[model samples]
Target: MLLPMSIQAKSYGWGFKKNTNHQPPDVGVYKNILDDLGGYYLDNSGDKVVYLTFDNGYEEGYTGKVLDVLKEKKVPATFFVTGHYVEDQEQLVKRMVNEGHIVGNHSYHHPDFTKLSKAKMKEELESLEEAVAKITDQKEMQYVRPPRGTFNKQSIQWANELGYTHVFWSLAFVDWNTDSQKGWKKAYQQVMDQIHPGAVILLHTVSKDNAEALAYMIDDLRKQGYSFRSLDDLVMKDILPEPIIGF
Candidate 1:
């Protein structure tokens, strides 16, 4: 099946949207392309499962607390850490692995991967993989979330060739700006209001608001019959048809 030009155009600048109705629009276009290319944006499991992920570019002061909450709740999450985070906080990264959390590659420098050449992109992934392997002793890092939520078809295909499953979120908010945090109540509402089945919720460990509201959010999500899953569990395998070359 040939991809529509409109879908291809949209893929270059696709950003996640928070659906109030909890129904993401015509993602088949995106999903079909990703499934064939070994990438993923949303999980359409139709079950009450939320894949919790955090983008840890660099630790602020809250990742430990965030990890503590996840530990208390016994919820598994994927933490996509940059090369700097791994280098600076080796123990924390080790703790994440020891605690049974999946550590994903967020690239070495956190550059907009859509802008890099295939070689540079591979370096971004490989350097992080080497660092993570040295720290966690887990040689195979299967998941990656592109920096700034920006990716193109070519970038996805390159990542696929490198044996990565690109992970994009189905739910996210403006929580990266620490100074702009509205409060825990507002954060809670922002997440709960858009909560849906099979939501890949993106949170930043840098946000104090997220640290404050995460436990409450977990409780509420469970009350609404949603359970958290790691990216390892949510990733689909053998679902893609033969690779469509030259995207």
Candidate 2:
């Protein structure tokens, strides 16, 4: 039988023994590895907005279809990709860039930033920064989401010093497990049920269930008066338009 969630976290390196509150990563200060990484913090005050993001650790087997849905919907998004996956899925990454989506680094080995040594973390991030540069002209890949939402004050300081804005999820669904029976159904319900204004929904692109549910999820959210937006559209100060809907 499966162990409890808390126990599972221990086995999977998701516990808070590595964090101040046993919470997901948050920003503070990090060692400097680069000078252009961007970071984000809570900015939307009294507004109902949501930012959708995905971590491409490997592949969800449905990323292509997910991209197609986003492309068809003409909605922009941020795709956090790892170096190994980027190398393996070069064509898809190219398509993402060519199709006008934002691709950020998800580290090379998907290590928990807090668990890695400062130097190792720097290398992990820098390696991908270089690899992305090799594929695209966007030299300033400033955004990073630590693997498994693990971060700490020191790691955040280090990442910030390197110019990266560590992103964490406001909402996430269990779309990573292929063995789950109700993966897509549970994902759909979880996303729709908990969605709030300015939430950042985290989806894994390595799940076929997530892929199958992507378009429907977008449509459902749209029907509920939410519009899909890219992380860039939501955060970047100068690029965003005046607020259309807010609470």
Candidate 3:
């Protein structure tokens, strides 16, 4: 049995205990809070649908490969990007939008929303949305991945009021430290071992291993009977009740 978790309005660095049992992570009260706020980390449809998301702060030359793999595999993904990435890689950002992928906001300067005022949080999101809008066909950004996975109840509430949905991850690993990458196999195994139905998988575009393992991972996950979904699909599925869908 799981114990009830108490939530506070204070700043929180988002994290949860990973389960070897390959289940949706135990996010305690965080999940409930997000659920009520129209934010989500897991698909509630109880189906074998997986949403792939990537955090691109500043590219390390592997995003193109990742994009190529996604294109080849015909998988849809959401790329949450920072202002620095947009300023640095406008073409890549355009490509992400042009190739039928959703580009999400990771904030303009990549600051902790929990530390910013409501106005400033809106500014951060709107600024990134504007930057992305300038370079792509996406005129609006609807999802946000808080910088460094940090947020508070108030921060999330502000994002909600600002028309952005907070997107946290149910599956992730230490693939961000560019200096400590193990290998493609390790990345593949880590994801395979942790994947679950309705999971929102977070991968960093800076990870070379992730760039290399993405294709294989897609194939294997498809073989496991999992379907790839976009964040738009995830949110739409959520908005429409389970029974009402496909009726």
Candidate 4:
């Protein structure tokens, strides 16, 4: 089913933004750092593959539709859900797990990790992990995305101590405007121009435009010789090579 064109686009409305000297997180906060956050694209010998991930802070009225498209496409994705979204949309959380999508921690309240005290930061990460464990019966939730794409040395170090590989993204569309839908052609072009193997893409389920255009984008990427997979797969084996374009 196609999402109505009349359905307005929506932003994540995380209630915060971060402006730092660091390069915007393409995999996680450490993507701009020398050491890097996690190894997403370490080996580039295979066909171009894209990693699709979503940040779930709250409901924006389009997530369910996005899930439907993903389900139909038989594509797996990773969802970084905040504690709030997880609790608020527990049923959807169950669906994600049941449908074989990876659900990682996006923090309890979606705070900027670098600004929070070390203890508080750790609490944020662990609390969300615990919440998911309670519902999914899974004890491990190792992937993370810092709220607002903000992080620092201490934040990354603390997360590592907690055993999380901070995940950011390399490609994104302007889907955060609640007033106007990000045009499908623009969204498709933005991604196609930057298509790379092991690239992590951040598209919010909040945007109806994203949901509507998703299937088409998937088909186009497949034709371009790129396969779609979840981030969980990238962490499990050495299937992707490190990106040569933006690192």
Candidate 5:
């Protein structure tokens, strides 16, 4: 679905048509606003590479396994964590940083930024940053994946003005709901079926299926000649027109 055309406060849940052709899903009309305000959905290159990311709203007891899989696979990823996650699971957040992964801001209260004033948005980000700073070595939060995948031009603009880059996803599935999981094999198949070049994949840490299928996914993807990269690499690519995707 398209985001509201106006520049006012309108909440938009991020979505796109699912593709099974190993290509980036068309983001419809979000291309313009994202391109104009530094939002990234996927890498613009056709190389066989992917960026792994997770949204941690609350712990479902699988992040440790997810981290273990990443450690075993030596794949660097970014975990966008909320305030509750940080406050509740400090060591896990610390482990994310100590293990060479990025800890992105998923906001403090996990509220809709479009409905919030710029100052409230800043407060939300900074509060999470401060909470994370006390527990992890990473002090400044440079990336933001909006709560519930919702945003607008004003929200993106405010984030940019606050020295943050908005990151959307090019590859995702219906894996967030814990009540109706489709099993690990289904999750694996979903990713493998929709896999593509330079895809910014969005997965939830709350998914037991994701944690179970992560290592296998990494191995099989590598077997397909794809290399996993970090969000740092993605951001650098955005800043410089080098060999990065999503230009």
Candidate 6:
């Protein structure tokens, strides 16, 4: 059976317009797709709250600093980590959990789940879950962010069957490129200009630019009357009930 045309696999590109009074049309479209599939991209609660998330595929000498900023600011955020990150950065992962932050599963090897069979996909998720559990003392892993922001109906369904909620970001920029660091000023402008209520913001833990601007970003966002939220507090309460398969 095929997914509904609205929920079919498509490369998720995070984008939005600046100085808008209403939710961007594209955001609404993506939100509906995730809503139908029991997933989430944006919070859309009309509150001045934003959910912060970081993708930690591997350590790049900046996660510690990022965590430091988060701790200093006392803002809760989620870290979606891979097997390599968990194995190599056990201390960092420990700190994340110890400091009241959520550690989410980003798969074992960071493969595009859309290209894998159901069993392979399960292994990818389960292996990472097992690693996180071992490190966090078997804390239940519930959130899954598809590597490279890619997914499909089958993969999402398989994840939900295993009691995982898929998370995609609603706001991200070209900060992943290490060679082309956009400087802290550009990073600050991009994030602050696009700030919106109930937005799921994605930042790479490896970006030095993000590290430099994180504290300032938090302060500026707060100045603008925005607050930070944890994904557990945001998505879990908003998830829709599982839809019947083969509709």
Best by lDDT: 5
TM-scores vs. true structure, each candidate? 0.88, 0.77, 0.93, 0.79, 0.94, 0.87
lDDT of 2 by residue, 25-69 (tens): 332232122123344532343344556688887764688998998
- Per-residue lDDT of model 4, residues 4-118, tens digit only: 3232121122211322222222333233442443433222344477778888888888888878988998888888999889889988888888888889888999887766776
Question: Each prediction's Cα RMSD?
Answer: 5.9, 8.7, 4.3, 10.9, 3.4, 5.9
lDDT of each: 0.82, 0.68, 0.87, 0.70, 0.89, 0.80
Best-to-worst order by TM-score is 5, 3, 1, 6, 4, 2
Error of 1 at 247 (Å): 38
lDDT of 2: 0.68
Better of 3 and 5 by TM-score: 5
lDDT of each residue in 68-111, candidate 5, tens digit only: 98988789999999999998999999999999999999999999
Residue 46 displacement in candidate 3 (angstroms): 1.9
lDDT of 3 by residue, 1-247 (tens): 2212233346677889987786788998787777766688888667888899999999899999999998888889999999999999999999999999999989999997877878898888898999998878999989999999998777877787888889999999999999999999999999999999889999999999999999999999989888888887777774666532210
* Candidates ranked, most accurate by lDDT first: 5, 3, 1, 6, 4, 2
Identify the leading candidate in terms of TM-score.
5
lDDT of 1: 0.82
Clash counts for all predictions: 0, 21, 0, 12, 4, 0
Candidate 3 off by > 4 Å: 1-9, 241-247
Query: Which consecutive 10 residues in model 6 have the weakest lDDT in total?
Result: 238-247
Q: What is the lDDT, from 0 to 100, of the residue 36 in candidate 1?
A: 65
